[model samples]
Target: MNRSHELQLLSLEMQNELFRILDFWSKKAIDSEFGGFVGRINAAGEVVPKASKGAVLNTRLLWTFSATYRKTSNELYRTMADRAYDYLLDYFWDKEDGGLFWECDYQGKPINTRKQAYGQGFGVYAFSEYFLATGNKESLAYARELFALLEEKYRDPEFEGYIEALSADWQLMEDMRLSPKDANSPKSMNTHLHILEPYTNLYRAWPNEKLKERILVLIKLFQKRIIDPKTGHFNLFFDRNWTVQSEIVSYGHDIEGAWLLHEAALETDETEVIQSVRQSALKLVEVTSNEGTDTDGSVWYEKEGDQIDKDRHWWVQAEAMVGLMDAWEITNDDWYFQGLQKAWEYIRANLLDTQNGEWFWSVDDQGNPNAKEDKVGFWKCPYHNSRALIELISRINKLKI
Candidate 1:
């Protein structure tokens, strides 16, 4: 078979595999025992009852299934999305506190009540899309509320960026850690990326004037502060005044941001923004090509100086495929298309757990999938991989039509 035909067949097979896993997890992962989804499921498909549930996982579940339902017109997918949406509103959202909680207990109580802007941004992201799917004004209003909260409390009027986290009552907190590895920075690429994400979704539903400007500014923030002009990799952490604060370079985030920044620009519809974003994205594609990719078609997690953690993360590969595909679409380059196909082949060959329903979170340098990462957990859900498959299928289908 020729190369084009080979890629078409491979993408078709990947789409089928992705839908199968989504169907399996949609049925198996729901928390009929408590509510929403069960807190954790290991590599063996064993549920961990004692694990505390996370807002990020549940919100992402709602968004993925909701988007899938819209894409496929599948009632089963819609049902799953509704379940997650109800659970998020009922359990995770802090009605009095004005944003979503960080974590929840097993029985659906608010355990980690701090308002992480990233989590709230995702809440808005999911709910706004849910509004589009179901026309639920309640969802739209809630999404807008979260948007306002982020702007009012987290956004820096003078400094031109969002703060990382706030206490339950909206006070700035001393401990601003998103994950243990992340530094306690007032601003972070992680938070800003997600904030941009939800704002894009909200604009789709509402199209408010202020929202549009904020989104425009966010793209500029990336160009001005986050993205390294020389290398195209985003600086992970930043001080309150937008000074670079971290040395670690996250390959996954670089690739993920490449596509997201493009989307932000495209969705905004400003010619200058799109032009600028297109330029930055091209540079990012080159940087990841040089520094991130391995000879095995996998991308590493990150590097701290000479210390390279060579583990191929599940989400990183998923994002890399989409980003490479985005690059191909933007530049019409054969190399980017080749890179997308190669990444998908690597994912199918190694990252996918055929016995289990989902992917292994990490894989070794030799392409052995890491067995320790849970199949379902606070950090792992159907979002990244499912979105990757949906994106690939849609883009190819659009191309065909």
Candidate 2:
């Protein structure tokens, strides 16, 4: 088949998969007893009623519903977005603290009230999309509020990058762990990549000079510090003084940040910034394409201290699609396009759970799905894969028109 025909077929399948996940999760995973979505759905697709809710998972659900509604113009999707929005206001929002909490109890009462910069950024992301879809002035104001808090508490005037985490009252914290898998470094590429992402979406809605300037600085920081020019992989952890603490490379963050960095730079419309960012991003795709991607076209997780996990993570595959597409756009390379298509094929064949609904957390190196990770949890959600589909549809349509 021709390229166009093949992409069209893949796009249709992606849409079906996206909708299937939305339907299944909306029907089963939502906490009717509680206000928001449930916190944990175990590997067997069982919702753990007592599991604590996470701000990241709730905010991502909000983004998914809002984006899905905007893309499909479906009232049901808007209702889902509204459900998540209400729960966010009621549970996640820290009225006295000025940002969202890190974790909440099963009944929507926040227990671990640490104000993570990552969670606050995603709050801005979800609220901005909610405002865009519904034109609710309150949602816009909430997004702006979160954005301001991030600036006030997280942005380092001397250091130039956002701080990793804070107390409930916005004081700096020492144990800044996003999860058990992550290193307890003072600075992380994951936090900064997310900061750039929400900043891009926030700028789309509320483009004030301050926001623009900070985003420009953020784009430059990745180009300078996060990205290793010699290797093209993102350095995982750093100290507060902007010194690299580890040489560990995450293939997922490299590819995800590649396109996301370009998105941030392109949003600013600074020719110099765009040129530099495009070079780094395209080179990122090239280097990781050589090292991380498998013959089956799926990207692998990182190696740590001589151990290669080789798990085909769901988010890595999703971001690989956008990264390859971004490379294709930058260089007009047929190989990048082929990479995107093949990666999607790999996801559909392996990562996607045709039996249960949403995707598995990962597949082993040999292409067998690992059944231990939760199907939906603090980490797993529809955001990564579904957003990939939405981004691909928009990018391809832009190319065609």
Candidate 3:
């Protein structure tokens, strides 16, 4: 097939998968007795209604449905977006303290009220998308509110980047871990990367001077503190003084950050920053493509020293596709296009749960899907895969190839 025909075919496949994802979440993931979506669903498609709802999950649901509604003009998607928005406001939003709670009970009551900067970033991201889709001034106001909260509560004036977690009253917490898997540190690249993402999206909706300035700082942070200039991989954990803490390499975050940083620079419309970030993004993508990808085109989960995590995670492969495609767009290189095709092939062949709806958490090095992880949970959501599809479709459509 010609390049145009190939892109058309890929676009069709991506659109179909995007809708399939929306259908699965809309039908299977809703909590009828409670508000918002259920907290957990197993790989077997059974809903765990009693599971504690997470701010990340709910906010991502808000973003997916809101973005889908904007793309398709489907009232079904709009309805889902509305459900997420109401649930977020009524349950997740901390009325007394301000900002969002990290977790809520199955019944929509506050459980873990700690304010995670990562979760707050997602709040801004979801709310801004919601505003864009519906032109709801309330959504825009809420997004702006979250942005202000981040700036006021999370920003470290003594240091450059934002803090990881805070107490219910917005005091700095001793244990600032985002999860048990993460290092207990004052700052994390993951949190900062996510903050940059939502801030960029929020800037697009609002375009306020403060937001623009914050986005520029975040872009510079990626270029300096978070990413290793020599290695091109992000330093996973850090102290308050910007001291690097961990040596782990997360391929997913590396690829995701590449595109995200580029997007942020583009949104800023600063020529110098854009030029610098473009080069940095290319290097990040190159490193990930070289060291992180398996022979079958699947991205490994992470690496620590010589001990490589060969598992092909669902989100990693999803982001790899988008990242590689972004690289292809930037360089007009056939190698990056092939890399994208390979990642998509790996996803379809291994990661996607053809029998059950949605994706597997990950597949092992041998291509066996791990059944232990929750299909839908705090860390697992439709955002990465669905957004990748949305991005790919839009990018491919714009390609003259």
Candidate with top lDDT is 3
Which lDDT tens digits does candidate 2 get at residues 1-401?
A: 97677767767777777788899778978898877888898877888879999999999999999998988999989999999999999988888867899899998888999988899999999999998888888988999998999888888888879888999987777888888877888888899889889989988888888999989888878888888767777888888788988877788888888899999999998999999999999888887799888888988898777777799999999999999999998998899999998898898889878777788899997788888999988888889988998888777766653
TM-score of each: 0.97, 0.97, 0.99
* Winner by TM-score between candidate 3 and candidate 1: 3
Estimate, for each residue in 302-336, the C-alpha lDDT of model 1 and write its tens digit: 99899999999999999999899899889889898
Measured on C-alpha atoms, candidate 1 has an lDDT of 0.88
Overall lDDT per candidate, in order of appearance: 0.88, 0.87, 0.91
Model 3 regions more than 4 Å off: none
Query: What does candidate 1 score on TM?
Result: 0.97
RMSD to truth, every model: 1.3, 1.2, 0.8
Most accurate candidate by TM-score: 3
- lDDT tens per residue, model 3, 1-401: 88899899999998998998888999989899887899999878888759999999999999999998998899999999999999999998988888999999899888899999999999999999999999999999999999999998899999889999999998878888999989999999999999999999998899999899999999888888989977989999999999999999999999999999999999999999989998999898999989998878888989999999998888999999988988888898999999999888888888778778899999888888898998999989999999999999988888776
Q: Judge candidate 1 at residue 144 and give its lDDT.
A: 95
Clashing pairs in 1: none
